[model samples]
Target: MEQSHQALSSKSEAFIEKENKYGAHNYHPLPVVLEKGEGVYVWDVDGKKYYDFLSAYSAVNQGHCHPKIVGAMVKQAQTLTLTSRAFYNDQLGPYEEFVTEYFGFDKVLPMNTGAEAVETALKICRKWAYEVKGIPENQAQIIVCENNFHGRTTTIISFSNDENARKSFGPFTAGFIKIPYDDIEALENALKSTNNIAGFLVEPIQGEAGVYVPADGYLAKAKALCEQYNALFIADEVQTGIARTGKLLAVHHENVQPDILILGKAISGGVYPVSAVLANNAVMNVIKPGQHGSTFGGNPVAAAVAIAALEVVRDENLSQNAAYLGVVLRTGLNEIASRNPLITLVRGKGLLNAIVINCDEDSDLAWDICMKFSEYGLLAKPTHGNKIRLAPPLVITETQIHECLGIIERALNDFR
Candidate 1:
């Protein structure tokens, strides 16, 4: 349906109220109640057109409701949706072959969401450390970064420093160490400090912590340190993978390949819940049958959707577009920051970008700015209290991006 130039009416308010009434208040969503999305745009129930600056947290890099991906999904769903890993399904084998080859991995294990895939990779790493690296069972330690947002899973939250995610959630799980991100010295110290180190799991670019792009060569150096210490270099590319950072994987920026790669979000173009963990024989073979499995993982419909989603990335040359547009976006945002005192900083790679508001982290100024942005026909979210992430779909055209930049500039001006 085409977007009509209307305000959020009682219709939108009703939906929000209904959700607040019944649903768990786990998420603090922007007040805009999205009802429909197409390309890089979303519409509320009242049919107001707004540029989708978030891209469902970079899941719709292929763009929302893409026809090719949806078509593949529909065809598969009509034929066979699930047969379980107990019985082979036609789509699973082909998808495994396609995705493994596409990402240049020797093998792939599928799961349904980002957190599940992360858990799966952790299992593979610890098992590899015990069975192969000869670490005593239950003593293997995985290194994570401070301010990393892997997921809400209990095991992941064990190593996290985020108070909101960790508050009252534990007695958290152990066997993990947290380190400062983008610090090569910290990584090396952690690695050399212990013999029972299983792996170093990290995001190529920390997306949730306000799109914090690490220093150049951090990933490469970290991976090399892991190799030197005989530990796995696991890259959690769930948010930064699949051409989101102008490379198929953010580590590609430094020509580093991970020992274990975890992916989700855009893997299925955000049309379905699909995640994958890719590794070579040495690491992956550690997990035997019944050691780990997901009933919904590798289902036929997911297989079909993932294959199509990946194809769209290649066919559209999204990596190149993102690379070029990233330069344009950062340049533009930098210019805006120069003129707008409200915007203290702008930083990111490709479409995954953020602007720091000139306020304390505890201040709600960033949230208030987002409300003004919504009024001006753009949708973005504040992270870390005083930073707003601006990752739109990679499929956005230069013209549309400039238009959105105008909206952003105007929104910043309003704050002045």
Candidate 2:
């Protein structure tokens, strides 16, 4: 059995080689072939271990292969997995109730990916504009932020200002107004001037845009403005929600509740693809039957998995854990940044943090630092070019955090 396992590992490497040779060149990942993962760590195909600082882009916030989440998945799979919305399932209602209550929403529309959730929100906003807000059809506008990384769908990418994401993806979807992030004035100006606006969609913290956190009170003021204008406030917390940002949701930091909440990634604790669009009945009921849905959306297995995943966050107090350790990790990084000229800035909240490299966006400096981090047994990824996002699982312990910090410090010194 041991020899057969070794042969399987060798075959996996060969498969990876074939993938690089044949697959689309869309993603330029680091040269590490991960084979297995546990809490806060992953082992490469070569049996080398590394701390997982990226946390699967904050998908594995409950840590990799959490036994509870996986166990739920196993039990459900053995019993029942998929029952499309065409028929009622036993798991969907209970899971919906659990998730809606967890996030303080009245209803939830399930989807399979972050982009689908964003797309769902957009559709809901537009429908609500016409039906609820009495806006003319095809004239409802949604406000977005500059440098926002919502998702990669055609309609979602249409509002993206990133050239790589937007180039040649036209003629784009209309009805979106773009504003600078962290600037309340721009949002206020847009909101004041626009009458047919349906909603304001934003990432509380721009995760894929290198973890750009908005200014203090930005969300609070923005939600207020949306209320004043009678427009829906849609928050794309797909990357920052489910306790990734110390709070159950990032908007909680400002005591703001969005009208429409988009959640994904860690909602399944990295066990499955489960995303949801949450809102009150007023906004959600705008979409009657046959308006929007996915074949796999709200499947029995996804519902079951998401309920267990969210329960873990509450039971384990992962939000409080992230809050405490985030300060420690950011402080450590900031201290290191002060001493290193190569590191221009270190900024983030909770477990979602990033270090900006003092080099060109296209430079390999960030990649070099990541490789060095791997050598020191910590794994992370570079977003954009010269920025590396450090988002460990919220389940990580303080001792593990310090150990990871030691690895990061060594990587910084070694890179120098």
Candidate 3:
């Protein structure tokens, strides 16, 4: 029997109509609809090519549809996919060993999304506080920073300062102390002023808060303060880990090892959904069997994909490339900013960089600028209202980077 299929057109209007009619309206994505991607570039449904500057929010740090990562996933999908953690699969133990050793942690608890991994860390921190640190049950407090973007879950959003993410989503969870980001004094004071404090959760660089980088020595000092107060230092590297930040982990910039590390996004090179919580025995041991688990968390396919992804990070020397290219990117953008009055400031580390538009937060200038960028064959979007993050895949070449720089300059120049 022969199977037949309808040939789709390169025109984007009808496809966009289908999405608008049926898809959830949660995200206000750019008008362009991407249908294919390879390395640093993507093609729209209309067959227009553009540089992929966002990299799926750093999930595709290895690049779009990387052959090695996709190959590993295909092989594993053919072999074994899931066993539900009720019975261990062969790949689970090996992956646990590999990731733990790679990240210099004693153990790894696998999950399928960044939010789940964050929730896992939060649970571990609280349990360790109650059982190991001798805090009374139901009294553990975890400190979080303001303007943080951990995830969209109810409990995760409880401490979010973003009104849009939190509005009408609560009766929010309690026991989280909110303090300003990059403030060492505030963190130290919070630690000293509170008891039953389980952990201090932070992003090494606040990616969703418009790519806000902390002051020098802030992470190291904050970790020391957590040590002094016997609270866990939790680094949520969901968006900044896996060579996206010119290092395996952004916290490496400060030479600080977190008490518990939460990771996701590029863990499987964006080929599959995989996330993990890594910690030494003292913190991880608090979670007993039957207390915490997930159905597809440590599935064989996820294990294999993550292994190949981490291997790619190591084999490709992506961290070094990101470091070099980041400097080139920032320097290029800074020069462009000098000539163009619209781009106010450029900031970030590694490929995870952004340019601030010279406009008010409520203005449409940034969004309009992104539309201009799309027209100019470069794809990027505004983070808040006026800040646009430009993190391309780590595998992007130096030549392609400069080419994209030209596209950006043209976009800024042409924007009215």
Output the number of the lDDT-best candidate. Answer: 3
- Lowest summed lDDT across 10 adjacent residues in model 1 is found at 1-10
For model 1, residues 1-416, the per-residue Cα lDDT tens digits are 11223355788889989999999999998778888999999988778889999988889999999999999999999999988899988899999999999989899999999999999999999999999999998999999999999999999988988888889988888899899999999999999898999999999999989999898888888988998999999999999999999998899999999999999999999999999999998889988899999999999999999999999999999999998998899999899888888888889998889999999999878888888788889999999999999999999999988898999998778667
lDDT (Cα, tens digit) per residue for candidate 3, span 205-245: 99988999999999999999999999999999999999888
Tell me how candidate 3 scores on lDDT: 0.92
What are the runs in model 1 whose C-alpha is more than 4 Å off? 1-8
Q: Say which candidate scores most in TM-score.
A: 1
Candidate 2 per-residue lDDT over residues 1-416, each given as its tens digit: 00101123575568678878999887877667888999898998778888899998899999999999999999999998887889999999999898888888899999999999999999999999998889998999999999999888899888997899788877888889999999989998999886998999999999888889888999999999999999999999999998998999999999999999999999999999999999999889888899898999999899989999999999999999999999999998888888777789988999999999988999877888887787768889999899999999888898998898888877777656
Off by over 4 Å in 3: 1-10
Give Cα-based local distance difference scores for all models.
Answer: 0.91, 0.90, 0.92
Estimated TM-score for each candidate? 0.98, 0.96, 0.97
